[model samples]
Target: MKERHTSLLMFGLIASIALFFMLNLVLGSVEIPVRAVIRVLLGEEENTIWRNIILKSRLPQSLTAIMAGAGLAVSGLMMQTVFRNPLAGPSVLGISSGASLGVAFVILLSGSIGGVALSQLGFIGEVTLTLSAIAGSLLIMILIAYVSQKVRGNVSLLIMGVMIGYIATAIIGVLKFFSAEEDIRAYVIWGLGSFARVSGGQTTVFVVIMLVVLPFSFLLTKTLNLLLLGDSYARNLGLNIKRARLLVISCAGILVAIVTAYCGPIVFLGLAVPHICRGLFHTSNHAVLLPASLCAGASLALLCNLIARMPGFEGALPVNSVTALVGAPVVMWVLFNKRKSER
Candidate 1:
């Protein structure tokens, strides 16, 4: 009976993702008809204007939301399980902050030091921002990976990651203070987060990177389940605790890094999606929780994306804002239910 229920829930999540994705394409600010959206997606639409909007804008945004959501959700689940803390998340490791710091240097320092604001450079600016974010995140990930090997304790490693985040944030703050007003404004906008940021060929690359990396997470599911059993127990059961920790952390870090690089530190989805999945499925088993988080993340992201771009808003709302509005309540419900159960 439980297996059947789980299967049904998974199916529903996939269906929701599909529905929300279609809604995103069809119900944007321009109000493209459902039929027209479908025709455009099928390469049958003859209207070049609608074709450009659908093909060049909405399609990439929808795909980015799906991939980014799935990647972050899975990363959060891994971090929570590895650290054995429900509050643990992708940002806890400071990978997102590292990406932010990189962007800060580009957007905040460029005008002050180089006498030219990269933010106004258009395509070149966007490309530079993306690359800098990737470089910064990978650098931090490498540092964390090194620390993981030496620390031998998840608590200590987690603390170090937090400290790294603080340091990065401090640097960003200093840069912001010295930056020009226009540069600061640009940085703030990037920090607000947007799915529409990754458009055109960049979206394709982001999707491909996620497709290649996300499956590697599933490979660690068994390792994650074993880690959940506690280190001593898992070790006695033939698991190499240290190696497994490194693998899980590396996987989670990479996901957070890439997602933050492209989407600009999207909040709440990573921290909330795993908990939502656990509450729905009522299981600690990663086997179910991992896939559940993936689909649920994608679905929720699509829903958030849809809401952000709804008619009245004209897509002015940041993706992060919608995610917090949606995610906070879900998290509150999870906590409330947990507390009641304890009672």
Candidate 2:
């Protein structure tokens, strides 16, 4: 009976993802008819304006939301599991901070040092930000990997990660203080986060990269489940705790890095989705929770994206705002329910 229920819930999540995805393409600032959207997707629409709007804008944005949501949620789950803390988010290891610091240097420093604002450089600016974010995140990830091997305790490693984040934030703050007003404004906009930030061929590459990396997470499900049994027991069962910790951290760090590189530092989805999945499925098993988080994350992100672009507001709201507003309540509800059940 429980298995059947879980299956139904999974089905519901997938259905919601599809519904929201279609709604995203159909309902935007300029209303496109459902039929027209379908026709455009099917390559039967002849109206170039509607076609371009759907293909060039909505399609890529929706895809980006999916990939970003799934990647972040999975990364969060891994972080929580490895650290044994429900509050352990994808950003807990400072990978996102590293990415942000990189962008800070590019957007903040270019104005002060180069005498030319990189933010005004258009495509060149965007490319530079993406690359810098990747480089910064990977660099931190490498450092974390090294520290993981040196430090035997997860707590020690976690503390080091937090200190690294603080150091990065301090550097970014110093840069922002010295940066020009326009550069600071540009940096703030990027910090707000946006699915629309990625478009055209970039969207395809982002989705493809996520598709490649996400499946590798599933491969760690068993390792994750064993880790849940605690280090001593897991070791008794022949699990290499050190190696497993490194792999999980590496996997989660890479996921966070990639998503942050492309989408900016999207919050809440990573921290909330795993809890949402656990509440829905009522299980700690990674095999179940992992996929559940993936689908739930995609659906939630699509819903947030849809709301952000809903017809009321001109342009679109920042994705980070919508996510925090939507995700915070859900997380609170899950926690409330869990506490009530315990009582």
Candidate 3:
């Protein structure tokens, strides 16, 4: 019965993901016909402009949203499970804040601190941004893993992670104040987050990186299952707790860094989707939960991307804004339903 229920839920989520994905492709600023989109996708179309719009713009953006949503959702599930905290997430671990700080260093301090203006750097400037974000996030994740080894208590480690995030944010604020308005504005948009920023060659690279790393997380399912039985029992079962924690965190951090590097710091989907999956599937099993969260996150992101670009909003809405507006309600619904079930 449990397996049957999980299968049904997974099928539903898969269908929703497909629906939202199609909606995103068909409902952008220029509403391309579904038939045209299908034809364009299959290389059976002659309309160059429509084909270009679908392939160059909307398709890449949709693909980006899918990867961003799936990667962050998986990262959040890892953080929450590792910390055993309901509220723990990718940002809670200081990963995204670290990425922001890295970006701040590049954008705000490019001329003054680095003695190299970003604009003059050209293509190298973009490379610098991605590298900086990855380096900063990796450094923080390494610190957290080290702290996890020494802290003993999950809550203490969690608290330390939060403190680390705050410190990173404070640093960024000071940089923003001293920086020029243009740089600050750029940073602000990056912080607002968007699925439309990545494209073409960059999109291929981004999606490939996610595809490679995401599967590695699934391999840890047996290990993760062991973890749910508590530390003592997991230890008894021959789980190398510290190594497992470090590996899991490293995976989560990389996912966040890559997504944030391209899409900015998208909010809520990561933190919310895992909870929603749990509520829907009624199981803690990583085998089912991970795939369900991936699908749910993808569906939610595509839905948000579609809404953000809707004609009513004139496509002016930020992905972050849409995610928060749409996601918060879903999160609340999940919590309320969970509580009601418990009651």
Which candidate wins on lDDT?
A: 2
What is the Cα-based lDDT of residue 192 in candidate 1?
Answer: 90
lDDT of 2 by residue, 1-343 (tens): 9999999999999999999999999897788999999999999999999999999999999999999999999999999999888888988899999999999999998898999999789877888999999999989999999999999777888899999999999999999988899999998888888889997989998999999999999999999999999999999999999899999999999999999999999999999999999988989999999999999999999999898988885455899999999999998898899888877
| Candidate lDDT values, in order | 0.92, 0.93, 0.87
**What would you estimate as the lDDT of candidate 1?**
0.92
Off by over 4 Å in 2: 341-343
Best-first order by lDDT = 2, 1, 3
Cα shift from native, residue 274, model 1 (Å):
0.2
What's the TM for model 1? 0.97
Tens digits of per-residue lDDT for model 3, 1-343: 9889889999999999899989888986688899998999999999999999999999999999999999999889988898888798888989999898888888889866776667456567777777888878878888888898888878888899999999999999998888877788777877898888786888899899999988988988988888888789999999999888878888888899889888888989889999999999888999988898889988999999998989878658998989889988988898899899998
How many clashing pairs per prediction, in order?
0, 0, 0
Clashing pairs in 3: none
After TM-score superposition, the amount by which residue 313's alpha carbon in candidate 1 deviates from its true location, in angstroms, is 1.3
